[model samples]
Target: MPPVKKIVMWLVVIFLLYAIFTSPDSAADIFGSAWDVVANGVRNIGRFFDSLISRS
Candidate 1:
């Protein structure tokens, strides 16, 4: 990866670590919401492909 991208990634990692250690509840909530969003996106993509197949 590029240098700037690496630096930004490190900063995000540090922040997440701080959040996890200092306030675990908030961290869990944040991660849970992120996972929910990803799951929904994947489900939507599957539905879209299923619809296309049915139409053909």
Candidate 2:
């Protein structure tokens, strides 16, 4: 990776650690919403493939 990308990544990691330590509840909610979005995307993919197979 480039130098700028590494610096940005480190900043994000530090901010996340700060958020986790300062306000755990808010961080948990943030993570929960993110997980829900990922889960829904995966479920939608599965449904799409299932329908395609069923039609064949």
Q: Evaluated with lDDT, which candidate comes out highest?
A: 2
Cα lDDT over the full model 1 = 0.97
Root-mean-square deviation of candidate 2: 1.0
Cα lDDT, model 2, residue 37: 100
Overall lDDT per candidate, in order of appearance: 0.97, 0.99
For every candidate in turn, the CA RMSD to the true structure comes to 1.6, 1.0
Model 1: what TM-score? 0.87
What is the lDDT for 2 in model 2? 100
Cα error of candidate 2 at position 36, Å: 0.6
* TM, every model: 0.87, 0.95
Candidate 1 runs further than 4 Å off: none
